[model samples]
Target: MPVPADQAHPLTADVAIVGGGIIGLATAWRLTRAGLSAIVIDPSPGSGASLSAAGMIAPVSEMSYQHGRLFALMRDSAAEYPTFVAALEADAQTDVGYRETETLVCAADPADRQMLADLQHYQQAAGGEVEALTSRAARRLEPALSPSLSGAFHSAGDHQVNPRRITAALQTVLPAIIRRTAVELIETESSSGTAVTGVRLDDGRTITAPVTVLATGMTPTRAPLPDDVPLPLRPIRGEVLRTRLPSGLPPLLEHTIRGIVTGRPIYLVPRADGEIVIGATSREDNREGPSVEGVSQLLRDAQRLVPGIGECELTEVTARARPGTHDDAPYLGTVGTAGRGPISGLIVANGFYRHGILLTPLASRLAAQLVLRELDPPTVPESTDHPATADTDHHHLQTMNPRRIAHPAAENQPQGGRP
Candidate 1:
């Protein structure tokens, strides 16, 4: 329970996390365990884009994440899931629904078949683990799959977790998660330059801290940076549906199904509780809720690859706007991370796009690592255009830096006439 502004005293912490989503809360948890006082500011946490996540930890399927450092970051994060979830569950005292099931990427037609093969080729080329299966082989693994589908690729190590449960568990351990939105970042002058001092909440309550993290996804309601820097945060709306398995339908799928209809990916995640989540439709139009066409398309595509879906009961249709950067990569470094480093006080860990759920562990780790100054931050990748020669931790950091998108030229130019 958080104290209301009227009754609350001036609170402070070692670090102030400005979003209660998985990344922010998880980072708070780690900081608390490290003996650092932390507070999470979000009116309603875990109810953002996380609500619509399919929760598939498939590095193979998300090969490049629009193709960049996100690929290695996702792969590394997926590798960390087993141990990370185990520890998180132990601490949170709740079952986060971390099931280690394989993923099957199914196709619908000749073009889709070639798409599957091409994905396999890319995955293999990227040194990811994937196996090609004929249509019969795929059905053998997941009999509920349509018999007439073209082909499929299986990633044996991929798995799924319930994002809601994960967020719930995180909240359990992070009781101090403030139920108010942060309205601004307090900054102070430093030898290195401008550094974050704390955050001011919407209720006019202020919490001073040495460090502040901006984990607010999609809509960065208030930007802490100076007028010079360009955050360029855009919203990419997505829609997903949840269904309960009906009794008389084909047996619930045991493997995660990732189907490619035309070019887009349709993920069907199975839960231990007779729930199958069918998602998602990616659209550039930034909207708040699910549209009729978006939800209809998901059901239509899902049923095409797994006909049994038609028998499932529609339990939910969720929609949210994901945060996308101009570079199409996530921003995971300090406001000054990309060559602007002396801005000491702020760390940004948002703009994860569609990979937010999969990137939680790494993002949390990064937040703690950055605040502690435990290690020298990784090199900032020159540009998102080139593929990383190595998948080192530094490579991941360099690629996801928020400063990458803060265009220097655009920073100084006044916007049209608006000051």
Candidate 2:
């Protein structure tokens, strides 16, 4: 059962997060652990793109030739995932679906082999460890691969995690006041039209805090932000399909597979359960609804890569809009102009695109450290507290309890099997 909104406690924290996605939850968890009171406000926590994400932590697999800084950030974040997941599981006492399997990049056509070869050359030049593999040798690693596969490359460091489980675990474990409501930031005061002071919510409630972090995914585009804040964020739509294999379907595709066709890129990821996810068509302009043409094209392309998918049971088809920036790189670090002293008390941590889950651990740590004003412990955030406000409204404020506030919505409710 879902946690009741009426029963949710209301209290001010040292920092307040605007989104409840993986990034926000991870940030809130790290902040609360550092002894600072943190609050996360979102209407639906895990129902966004994070839920529909394929959760591939591929710093090298998704590497590009131009973006060196972005690749460094992703590499740092990927390296932190193991430690992050271990600590989170130990703290939350729940499994977060962490997997350390390597990823394979395959090519089916002779023309596509050059793309893999170019990627191999690029990876080598960028000091990444990638191994060129023949089709026969590739089948040795994953037996279900198509016999007609041309060539492949192996990236041992690439990993994946279940995004839903991570989001659920963060929501369950964090000592944050999770409020299931929409919040809009109303600027109360500014200096030189650059610095922001406080924000007012939609329900006439005002929150005055020393620091506020905007982790509101693509919603920041719609927020009343300053013109100087160059968010440069937009949304990119991706369509994904999920299917289940029969009891004895020979365990097709052990590692994540990517195909570099003449057109866009396509990928397939297999879960621990029988579910195999084939995704992602990138659409530049249209993001209104799921594209039947897109889905059909992906299925056709995926089947061409691996022929055995013809017999799988189609379970679900879903679409999600990733928060993309102008250069496809997330905006991290302090907001405001160089001479403006860090925009007073606001920070922007959005525009992660499809890499939100892959980059959460490091991003959360950086956000928490910025909010807490800590100097040491370079990469991630730890729990800590800040000075509480003098005017504490006990009547209006809910009790200060993390478990009570972050409880799942469906807990303690009668469960009738999915109808």
Best by lDDT: 1
Q: Alpha carbon lDDT of residue 66, candidate 1?
A: 45
Residue pairs with colliding backbones in model 1 are 64-67, 196-345
- Give the per-residue lDDT of model 2 (tens digit) for 300-324: 8888777777778888888877888
Candidate lDDT scores, in order, read 0.76, 0.69
What is candidate 2's CA lDDT for residue 96?
81
Cα miss at 227, model 2 (Å)?
3.3
Where does model 2 exceed 4 Å of error? Answer: 1-11, 177-183, 186-198, 220-222, 337-341, 374-419
Identify the leading candidate in terms of TM-score: 1
* Model 2 residue 139 lDDT score: 89
Tens-place lDDT per residue, model 1, 173-198, is 77477777777778787565676788
Q: How many backbone clashes does candidate 2 have?
A: 18
Q: Against the true structure, what is each candidate's TM-score?
A: 0.89, 0.83
